[model samples]
Target: MEEKMNSGLVTSSRKKLTIVDTDVHHGYRAQSDLYPYLTKFNAERFAEWGFGGLSTHLYTSSGGLHGQRVDFDAGEAGDGLGTIGDAHYCSTRLLDANGIDLAVLTGGIAGAASALPDVDYGSALCRAFNDHSMEHWIAKDPRFRLNLDINSQDPLGAAAEIDRLGSHPAVCGVMFSCGAPKPFGQRFYHPIYEACARHGLAVTMHFGSEGEGVNPPPSAAGFPSYYIESRQLRPPAYAVHLASFIFEGVFEKFPTLKVAMVESGFAWVAPLIWKMDLDWKGLRRHTPWVKRLPSEYLVDHFRFGTQPLDEPADPEAIKHIINWIGGSRTLMFASDFPHWDADDPMMTLSDQPEDLRRRIFAENAIETYKLSLPAISQAA
Candidate 1:
């Protein structure tokens, strides 16, 4: 297969602003601490079944996981360390190196780690991972932010764990998987929303999963098998979640809770949302329980990231998504940094007119994450 050609430099003279690297995989730090704890039982059992553990899949590119793959060549980007550079290539590093006011570090690998069935062993590993993150990645530097990856299989238990750590002040939200239950709905995951609501924390549903069977695996009936299936799964999942909350009354159940869909490209937002609202109006009698348009419920509850944007990169699509979601106020910018094909972030608004750029890159995150400027001001 031919390698993708990297795009030209992100051309813009616009001043940089605080950026949040919402999706990151801290590989070396994770490998050091996470590798040793995998019990021989888990490792051996996985091996017996032709299954791979964190060590095999995540640490090695030949395996399916790609944490190491993305960083494999970042060193040549001028940051020194190979693929995985020191702090600068990491989220916290970028925050200091760039004018990024805050950083939210998330894991695409840890979700898979939590899915392994060791129960006590698995959960223990989860704690170790979070503790490692808190101590090394987040605590090592003061400005970086951390969001707990709440493994979805046992959300209630996960929620309790989140509540226990909720007071940490470093963890700002819980990250749930897209299509977590095969079909999406918050009912099975209410405890998480409850805990988050009680603690005034936000909930982020990030795209991609490493086959943690908390929910049923996806089916190809209407889905594709490639990675793009993951993208296809998101809109429908969001639709189900929104429908459940509207029809099943989740927001009424918990007034303060908020959710953000991370790494879910915004291209589908317009048409999907329009279909949702239209269906709600035209098909209401089928589910009289729902009192509002799906669009209304969604605007109040969801925030979407601009990374992993769909293939076309059409400006019209972006505008449509923003308009359908109740304006540019509903979208947030994300770098998804260090990952292969990561939006250079600087390019997020480069092609757009100035006003839309400001809304997506800055304003929306402030409103959604409830971010506030640091007491010590920095260059905008």
Candidate 2:
């Protein structure tokens, strides 16, 4: 268990841009690593039945294990079998290589915690994962900001968990996994949202746990048969949650609360909002609390991350999607690092204007999660 060592500085002088990767996945070698953080009762549960979620059992992985990076020296300098954890390895291989100023560590298995049948167990798992992250990853790197993993099943417990860890300096947001029993409106999960709003933490729904554990099927028509169909289903699912958050008055009640929809595509935002706005106009009385157009709420309170970004032959294609989703203000850059489909900073949107690229790559993330970092000056 030796840590790979490096300066941990981004060496931004080379790139002359402040890059913030909003969706970096940090993982544990095994559940045993988190045993110290878990309660004795739950520790036994974890030991008996590991990762009680069905998402992994269904999907086929690509690239390396779990579709992680295949080129990094995961164990030794000659290039090893893994690249998921080890903070210093990330510093040398990812941050320094790309000149990234900061990265938000979005816990990998956190989503499965939400999908578990037992609400109390799910919340406990989220808590243990949070504790494990605070020790292993956050304590290891200043560049690493964490989004606290929270179970959506136990709203009050999740809210209480947020109260416990929300004020931690390294915590910028919360990772609420998808595959929720209900689309995240319904006032059922308001306590969690309230706590996040109280602490200025963004509620980031990273795409995982689509059809897993006790959660519902990924789609209303039942589970999709193939991986490609599930990938395409991401945006529509997000659109449902987005609509739930808006129409159910989640945003109206918690005005300052922000959400980061991660790994879910952004192209559906336009059509969803258009239909929502049209329906609201004709049927505003059904939910009178929604005082404004859905798009207005989206513009003010939501941020979408770009990974597996749609790469049309030209970079210009993304701008249309960007404009449809309230401009670059709502777009945050996410690399989905260590995964096979991860986006490259220099390669994605390389042809865009410097300012726009800066916003999407760095500034939007900084704004979305309300992180306070010193201004970066470009190299002369």
Candidate 3:
């Protein structure tokens, strides 16, 4: 039997399956594109001080097309070339072409602006980007869902934004863009998490913002010089955030809150969970509020994206790692679309069992994001 997905892609199967991509990126064509969304004050400030409201210099590093795929066309035609492109490119190359049921739009500006020293300006930029994303990306396709880009610097403002757009039928989660001044589990961020739980929105902490503006160094040893070196530091950053959330008791406060670590590899998760369980056995006295083991919260409330999928020398080792991490329930397929390192859905985790593959590609996301089949299918 043939079952048609909400995205209008039909699959030869009795049961309808959804391919929920958790980490698709949609960026603006230019800084000027946000001008209309910005307030009069922020617009003038942007003209004078640029992005950070202090310096025009952005985090510079050597990488081909800023790590985007070389073959990705920016919809260039004649004189109308040199644009930054938008979600349509993703729809063309990834979503539509790959039979993706739903893809989450994780915008760049919201995360980038989170590092700015000026909290008010950073919050404004996040709001502007959310508006821009709603108008340009989410409104264009039902297959796409929004991860509300928020500024962690202003928790109150972040919560307010969540309240404003949290109920939007197209919105599924909230994104912090990683690079926050403090660990997400701290008291400072509880308000944001509280707002997310209220809206039944998952929280996605994507990789970015480290060592830029007011954000701390990427790793404990301080900043690394090369892009490769910086990429190597992402896992540890995720580990720290996970530890903070577990130890600080964020889960106990908002039991329904779900957290997804996007663009952060999953190989380190098994070890981190094992080690935390070992330490918690003895250290449980200090953080008594954490009634269960640390790993329990992780397996219950946490999820990991499968992009930049850990490629060890032994290909079979990937299977072993996935088994150790609790199978498809803990992993979601993320393509990091339009980026140079995007994974091809047909190729990712091909060796996994059919059941596991279905969960990673679709089932896990449906449960985590609390999405309905009819809603997802109708969007397509």
Scored by CA lDDT, what does every candidate get?
0.58, 0.77, 0.78
Runs in model 2 deviating more than 4 A are 1-14, 53-57, 63-66, 73-83, 313-315, 374-380
lDDT of 2 at 120: 86
Residues 1-380 of candidate 3 have per-residue lDDT tens digits of: 24432243545441244578888777677667778989999988876766654221233442445455666664521111112356666665566666777888765566567788788898888888889889988887778888888888889999999999999988899887667788888999888988998899999888776777888777888867776777778888888888999999998899998898888889999999899999999889999999998878988999999988999999989998998888668999998766667787767887778888888988888888887544545333
> What are the per-residue Cα lDDT tens digits for candidate 1 across 1-380?
22222322212232355455555444343244444445666445433542133332221332112533353454423111112334445633445434455666655334554455544544555555576566656656555666775556666667767877876766777776554543335477688778887777787776544333443454436435565444456666555555565666677777676777776777666777778788778888987756777777777877777777664555576555556666566677776655555665655656666677767776766666665555432533
What is the TM-score of each predicted model, taking all chains together?
0.77, 0.90, 0.90
Model 2 agreement with the true structure over 77-167: per-residue lDDT tens digits: 2111122657777766777767777889885556777788787887887888788888878887778899998888889998999999999
Looking at candidate 1, what is the lDDT of residue 379?
Answer: 36
Model 1 residue 42 CA deviation (Å) reads 9.2
- Judged by whole-model lDDT over C-alpha atoms, candidate 3 comes out at 0.78
Candidate 3 differs from the real structure by a C-alpha RMSD in angstroms, to one decimal, of: 4.0
Q: Clashing pairs in model 3?
A: 6-377, 6-380, 7-380, 68-340, 69-340
State each candidate's clash count.
2, 3, 5
After superposition of all CA atoms, the RMSD between model 1 and the true structure is 6.1
